[model samples]
Target: MPDGNGTFVKDFFIVGFPGLHSTYYFLVSAVLCLVYIFILIANGMFLFMFATNKCLHKPMYFIYINLVLSDVLFSTSTLPKIIARYLFQDGTISFSACFFQMYLVHYFGAVSSYTLAIMAIDRYIAVCYPFGYHAIMSNRNTLILSIVIWVFSHPISIMMVVRAFPLPYCGTNTIIHCYCDHVSITRLACTDRAPYSFPAFVFAMVILLGSLAIIVFSYSFIIFAVLQISSTHGRLKTFSTCSSQLIIIALFFLPRCFNYLAANVGITFNANLQIVIILLYSLLPPMINPLLYSLKTEEVKKILISKLKKHQVHLTVLS
Candidate 1:
């Protein structure tokens, strides 16, 4: 293990976005910034609708609101920092700031994973034991679950943060990605230790793989239940509601799990693959969530369209 606690690694290098001419990179950045703006707006709307709408005050929507909140936080912690570094060309952060960024990134990432686990449990109760769904997944229980996620994530994230600070880094401090991720910094550590790497892998397993296993197990039962529905219409109706969530979860989980698992095993990850993986993880999940709800959900789509038309009407009236 490398050890450079007191001024061993002074500076780091960040190799911004891969394979774009300066002009092309600028154009891409403009588009990405616009996309991020929409992510904020759309996720905000989900949170607001869940809060304000009486009809949406249910366990399912409650978890959805948490999911949106987690997604927003995850993006907020990571993307803006990346954009500032790569797109804006201001790629410098102090040691403390870097650690803070890493901590928050892991914090929110853990939150999102735990939130997904709660959603999986919610789905299990709703689909598998429909009669007890209300009593089992009550608002109180959901709140408790959310609280547990935050509490559990904090200590685990803090462990990673604690281990990272002791490394004596006097060499390059440039991070290859936009954010101060653990992997990039770990590789740059002057004094590496099994503790840092192992804890990170442990957290990833607990949060990422643990949640994924729950999802798979719950959905397996769900699929069985769906198949048992006597009516084809009933089957389709049940499947339709869950399909979007399944897609969203898979998109969110697969690449992230792959990236981390590969990295943990000491694989030399391809930078180009990293960009694609990170982009999909960061952008696609948020981009698709609103689309899934608005497109596949009849009620949500109707409401969204109505809202759009109402805005148009207001403009027309003013004009």
Candidate 2:
């Protein structure tokens, strides 16, 4: 059936929000541009600081640098083309390019999930096993963990994309979402998508849920450890440190869970609303992570402040 339906789709039209009114495309495009700009600024700042500041090179920040890389790649994979699609009316993407985008879209996303879980594990060790934290999460081991996450998470996404790539996509060439992805691409194929779709969905769920489980498990122990602290001061301080991560986790996971439910359960949801949900979960995390994760750390905050002050002083002298 690969060629039974007709010519194989050589390219795909990224039909972002097909239901959206044409007149409002400008407004939507502007908003997307703003979010895209913020994502670049926030994540870029972290990467610059991490690379320039020798003191920032530690196990924790190593994991963060990895997240920054993934976020940059993730945003790059989707945003630039979508921006052009909106601003220039150039929505057509080559078939192979679309699949490659699908690979990176899923790969970096899974890497972020796994990287976050690694962060949670890092926090758990720091909180629960304070004495051995340094030895357990040594710089070398942390580097290895980050490398393993980048290396291994890729193949899982490859499996999902490979299954869909060979299927005959002879039907509609319009992708409903902003970018190429497993579900949107596979659903358009001529073949019975169940063979391809079901496994991919399950695999996606397993990655989502498994990483979330690890985070939850780590936090559970962290919470238990926090309770045993003797002073209210200690308890509040410990909990405060974790609050930002909890917010990031909720922002990233909750909307995604809802999107999955809406997709699979035959629930009638507005198409624009679905796109908005997708944007919220993916875009907000990277934009805010620099603040919530990096700046939240006292050491990083101090370093950033010192750097900013120095820059301001130099600017004043120049003026």
RMSD of 2: 2.4
Task: Tell me, by lDDT, which candidate is best.
Answer: 2
Regions of candidate 2 where Cα sits further than 4 Å from its true position: 1-5, 315-319
| Reference-based TM-score, model 2 | 0.94
- Estimated TM-score per prediction? 0.89, 0.94
Predicted candidate 1 versus true structure: per-residue lDDT over 1-319, tens digit per residue = 2224455654454555655567766676677688789899998887776666677777777777767877787778766665665577666676787788889888888887777777777877787898998999998888888788888888877888888877867655666676777777786776655667877888777788888898889889889999999999999988787888888788888888888888777776578667667877877887778777667766667677878999999999999
lDDT by residue for model 2 (86-107), tens: 7888989999999999999999
lDDT of 1 at 7: 51
| lDDT (0 to 1) per candidate | 0.76, 0.86
